[model samples]
Target: MTEAPATIMLNGKSRKIKQPCSATELLSELGWKPTQVVIEHNGQVIPRSETGAIMLREGDQVEIILPVAGG
Candidate 1:
């Protein structure tokens, strides 16, 4: 039997992703550049170096924050 897609809360919205994927893959899927945003997974800040190693699971809450540019 095939496994159901993983559903996660992304930026306060519900997003369904095919299977469990790494945070890096999630970023790519969303067309987001890792260097341009800060990732908070399950209420904890995830370091850029560990983004590739962290696996996204069903029901996980992810918050993506974009940095603001100022003059």
Candidate 2:
């Protein structure tokens, strides 16, 4: 099995991704909408418009937290 290229903490869980991809790349790859997901980098929240311009570094911590439709 191929090892992961990047490791990020997602909601207290460690996620190993294929590579250090931008938020836009990751979201599109996962079939998620940038507008619907909340993306945080190093505890700082970023807007959806920034996703495409932000470049990810190795060992960088990315948090993807989203809101659910439930009461």
Reference-based lDDT, each prediction: 0.90, 0.77
lDDT of 1 at 53: 88
Candidate 1, residues 1-71, lDDT tens digits: the string is: 66689999999999998775889999998899889888999999999988998898899999999878878
Model 1 residue 50 distance off true place after TM-score fit, in angstroms: 0.4
Mark the regions of model 1 whose C-alpha exceeds 4 Å error after superposition: none
Model 1's alpha-carbon lDDT is: 0.90
In angstroms, give how far residue 6 of model 1 lies from its true place: 0.8
Model 2 lDDT on a 0 to 1 scale? 0.77
TM-score of each: 0.88, 0.72
- lDDT for position 34 in model 1: 86
| Model 2 ranges with Cα > 4 A deviation | 1-4
Q: Residue by residue across 14-63, what tens digits does model 2's lDDT show?
A: 77667557788877877888988988887788888888877666666788
**Ten contiguous residues with the weakest lDDT in model 2:** 2-11
